[model samples]
Target chain A: MILLEEVWRTFQVGEAEVGALKGISLAIRRGDHVALVGPSGSGKSTLLHILGCLDRPTRGRYLFEERDTGSLSELERSALRQSRIGFVFQFFHLLSRLTAAGNVELPMMFAGVAPEERRTRAQEALRSVGLAHRAKHRPDQLSGGERQRVAIARAVVMGPSLLLADEPTGNLDRASSREVMELLERMNADGLTLVVVTHDPDIARRARRVIRLSDGTMEEEAP
Target chain B: MRAPDLLRFAAGALSGHRLRTLLSVAGVGVGVAAVVSLTALGEGARQYVVNEFTSLGSNLLIVMPGRVETTGSIPFGGVTHDLTLEDFQALVGRIYLIRSAAPLAVGSETLRHGDLGRTIPILGTTASYAEVRHLEMASGSFLPRRDPEEAGNEIVLGTKVARELFGGENPLGKLVRMGVWRFRVVGVAAPKGRSLLGFDMDDAAFVPVRTVMQAFDRRTLFRILLEVRSRGEMEQAKREVVRLLAERHHTQDVTVITQDAVLSAFSAILNALTLALAGIAAISLAVAGVGIMNVMLVSVSERRAEVGLLKALGATDGQVLAAFLAEASLLTGAGGLAGLGAGLAAVKILTAVYPAFPASPPAWAVGASLAVSVLVGLTFGLWPAYRATRLDPVNALMRR
Candidate 1:
């Protein structure tokens, strides 16, 4: 479970101050699939980043599993992100030098998992994402869909409880986007909390709940 | 984190940019070669001088009346009116520590044979000069002690001087005019190569000291060369010589030096020169270090994205730093080894080509070169590695 109370995030662009998220309150229970929908510069990514513990809110209390995240040090935050959360980016930011299996094994490596277990886990994760055949192929050698699948496998390899995906299908075609969405829905069905940020109405409609934002303010929550 | 893995990684990275790595490594190689070759040249010269001095024999003492400067232009104070033939006689006849004493008197005189004439050195010594100075007779006999007592105008020519005067014919029993005196040729000494002063000892003619004194009308003695029994007795022998000479000449300002003492002083000077040359050569190593730093900075800039990916994959800043440092150290270390091998091979080639002068690379030179290379790696590597480690993961990830 994740909770944010009166989260106010601000940024400094040269001489002026800008508020990306203005006093937003939200909570999502464990196993819930949520979609954050907003226009460009509407603070959805900022909210997601805060939830992922990648950035701290300028003024707010963020609680993950009933523990306050604001009190954690940078190293503790990194460890929390490493062990408890997984991320999938819109651009499919897979490491260029690593093969599909290598990218999937990266999170487990950081967690200090045993080498044998890491390989087995990476293989299983790749299989789950339907990328087992492309395990030995580097990102440059794989198709865009396969590359996204490899990124997904890397994101979920650590078995994190929360999956934060930012426009996972933004760069994919309709067929690949459908396949990626099905993969995320299946993982959500397995009881992992999935929070996806996107501008597509069709993708937002598929989630169990949708939170809409407008100009740094939460507009409404719809089921 | 393991050494082999680090090495593999460095090898791969270096090979990825072959031209850059080679240029940097070549910089270090040239630096090392410069250091080794220049220092070896200096060492070779020093060795040549030491060998030249050693060939003159050891544990002997030279008694001169005045203070003699070992190097530079000859000073006027070296001339003294203290030493005489009586001092040499006293040491040979009275001093218990004396082994053998040879009274030496030297002057430049012109010798002529028919139309050919040349200025030749005339060394006047007794019959014991052959034994004390290790001179061997090449063809004719040496003058006897009785010859000097009888004031016989007899002389011995060196191998080169004999050839110059008599040509292909035998110079034994041939008469040559030396400074208005027709001296009989009693012997021809064996050919000895150039001395440390660059004077050819084989080009000089030797005659009895009494004959020179009587012929040249010279009363002042220049020096007395003494052969001691052993090096351990040099101090005792010198003290006795000084005491006997001071009593006869009635002057305490006399110079008596053992051969080993002179050699030690020469060694000290040569050691200082070697160090100075090595120090100058070390500057090249510093320049090579700057080359490494420059190349590494470029490498870090080119591999920004790769570095970002590594960091995102859980590599700590320290690991990134260590990786770059390892690359630099490996390059410099390899350069040092290659330079050392090249320098030793050069020494071998030189020795083979000129057997008279053999150069040996000292152990300290090798050790110092290795140390200098490592220091260069560290000094030049730190800044670039620090820059790579401090790059922002977000910004780096965003870089194409």
Candidate 2:
């Protein structure tokens, strides 16, 4: 569940203030499959960052599960992200030094899970992503599809309520992209709320809800 | 994170860049090694000097002929007046605390026996020189305290001088020629080891003070060595001796030095020298700390993606900061251990090469060196670790 009341984000570049998001308002209930589609410079990533609690809305209220997120301290926001929200970046963002299981276990490690349980749960998460056989592989050792799957396992290892993926399949080939998209869709079908930001038309069409942004504001939405 | 896991993660991070990590560690290692080894050398020199002085004798006082003055180019204020046998006799008789006093009259002589002859330092002192100097006799008896007229022809050879002049044969009662005078060797003194100050007890011969004064035709004694009854009586004995000498001679020209004063002064100078050595060595440690900071800064910039990934995995700013700091400490701690081994090995080699060199490392120096390395890690690591915490996860990830 997410709610925004005319949220605005502005950036200062040199001497001018650039509006990344201009008075945008939106809401999505739990278990919803939503796609935010936009061309370059349309503030898609910025909005995703705000939704994931990595950034605060510059002007306006952002309420998650009926609680005002803007009122929380930085520490509290980090804790909220730690326990309740997950993020998937376009480039996978897996630490190259860590194995697939190590990457998957990182979220639970920060959550203070015991080593034995972290191992077991990380293995389970990898299994769910169909990457159990490659649990020991590092990011560089894995294919693009496998790396994205590993990133997904890491995102969901903490059992967050919402998953925010920003162009998760951007670096993958078409076949690997289909596999990753299918995996995300299956996760959504299992009732974990999913919000995917993508410029791919196929991904936008498959989502239960599609929101299009032309500039900083939403131009249209298919309910 | 759990403590073990945190450490594991830090170790993993350091292991990622093997060469960089090793170079930084080597920097710290060299610093610690320099500090430990240099301080050990200073400490060893201090101990050596202390041992040398201690060997001179305990509760001993020397009455030099001149008073030390604070002002002027000359350190001693008074004119060079000769301390006589009467001054030595009077100190022994008047000062109740004076256990014994020996008059020293030193000169160089060509000591000869048969065809063998060598130039050696010869000491002219009373029979009390044996007890006052704590000198042991290796063979035969020491020169007896007889009427100065009767014992004028007796001399005691030092261990090495006796061996050089007489080979393995006993030199006791054998006649040895000194200058134009022939004297009987009454005893051979035990070997006292050489000192860095160039005083070697085994290399000199001792004769009766009257014999030296008569032989050299010198009326003045070189110095008066006073042995106190106990360490506690040294100050009182010195005051009494000085008072008696000045009162009788009507001149305050004598400088009285107790063993404690010399020992304390030497200890103070050497302590400061050791501290200075350690300070100079600590500069190298500071340079090593800069190296750690440099590498850590480079690592921070290079690992932006990893830092971003951690944050995206729900790590807080504090966690990221702690991770980097932990990584630094791990490097320095390992480096310190390696340095400890290296420094100790160097000390061992030095001691082995020079058997008499006391190259033992002090415990506090070792502990402080290790502690300082860890502290350097924490101090120099702060900037890079702080920078990691300030990274915006969204931007950092996007940069990747």
Candidate 3:
């Protein structure tokens, strides 16, 4: 469960205060698959960042699982992000030096998991994302879709409750994009909540519910 | 994050930039090597001085006629009572700690053998001088044992003196005249080079103490050297000798000091020399630290996106800083090890090439250089690591 009431995210651009997300109120149930769709500067990524606890809202009450994130200290916020939230970037951001398994082992590593268990769990996560055979390959050695799958495995390796993905398949071909979406949908069906930010209408349609944003405010929501 | 994982992550990032890593490693390596090798030379010099002092006789104590710290009768009195032959004889008979004694009656004079004449320092000492000072004879025997007050005609030529006078044709039994006395050369001292006492032992001639006193018309003995049975008895012996001399002279007019005192002074000087060398070498290490800082800054800037990605994966700011710091430490740590090997190898080669110097690294120097290397890594790596952690994760992630 997530809640954001009257959230205003702003940035200081030189002398002017620019609002990235203005007065956004939204809610979603557990295990919900939601898509945030907008034009280039419509605050979709900012909203995703706030929801993932990477950034706090300027003025809002944003709560996750009944805990108000605004009240948490920096360390507590990081702990909350580590234990309950995962993020996937558009770039697939895999450390080029690491194999797919090593990439998946990262979050658990930051979570202080032991190396042996990290290896085992990372391998299992990689297998679940259909990257079992590609676990030994680095990001550069994998195809675009396989890289996204590896990123997805890394995201979910810690078994976080919420996964926020920004343009997960932005660089993939149509076939590879569909494969990545199906992989994410399968995880959601297994009761992992998913929130994706994208400009692609097709990817947005695949979500169980969609939220549209214009400028800095939420425009509409569709079932 | 676990420490090992953090190190692994940092190591992996370093491996991504092989040339950069190698350059910084080399930078620190050279600094450590300088520290190790220079300290080796410094330590070697100190040990050499120590060995020289030990060879001069560890238990030897000298009784100078006048106290260096005091003047006789408030600067307007007659010269301090000279150390007399009677004083030497009395100390020899009474001090049970005196294993051997060398009564010196020193004077400089020109000596003539046939048509050759050269001015050389003359040392007048008793027969026990050779045994106490560990002097080796090039040929013939030393001055015969006689009463300290009796003048003898026997003489000993130094290596250089004999070479200058006799030209290797065997100076034994040859007569040398000094200030009107023709003394027969009974022995020649072997080449002993320079003693640490600042005198060239190879360039001085020896005769009986009474001979120099009689020939030079000197009324007092130059000094008395008392060799103790063991080092442990020096302090007690010095006190007893000073007490006996004060009773005889009615004043403590002599300075009695053990060879250990002079040795310690030399050791202190040489130790400071070694420390100074280490300090100079440490400057190089700091310069290398600056190099490490520069390279690490570039590495941090280059890996900006990775920092953001790490934060997104739940790495805290401390974790990011630690990761980068680990990378810097790894660079300098490996460099320190490599430099240690290189420096020790250099010292080994130097020792092999010149065995006389005994070049080698001291344990403290080795420890300090290694510790300083890693400390340099931490100190210089701090700023870059801080920069990495301060990066805004959102802006960093936005960079594709």
Arranged by DockQ with the best first, the candidates are 3, 2, 1
| Candidate 3 positional error at B39, Å | 1.4
Question: How high is the lDDT of residue B58 in model 2?
Answer: 67
- Give one digit per residue, the lDDT tens place, for model 3 in A1-223: 9999999999899999999999999998999999999999899999998998888899989999999999988788888778789888899999999999999998899889999999999999988988899999989999999999999999888889999999998999999999999999999999999999999999998898899999898866646
- lDDT score, residue B362, model 3? 92
- On DockQ, the stronger of 1 and 3 is 3
Using lDDT as the measure, what is the rank order of every candidate, best first? 3, 2, 1
Worst 10 residues of 2 chain B by lDDT: B192-201
Question: Which pairs of residues collide in model 1?
Answer: none
TM-score ranking, best first:
3, 2, 1
- Misplaced by over 4 Å in model 3 are A221-223, B69-79, B194-199
Between the candidate structures 2 and 3, which one is better when assessed by lDDT? Answer: 3
Model 1 - which docking category? acceptable
Q: Highest DockQ: which candidate?
A: 3
- Stretches off by above 4 angstroms in model 2 are B64-101, B105-122, B136-142, B145-150, B157-181, B187-205, B213-222, B228-255
Which model, 1 or 2, shows the larger DockQ? 2
Candidate 3: lDDT of B355?
A: 94
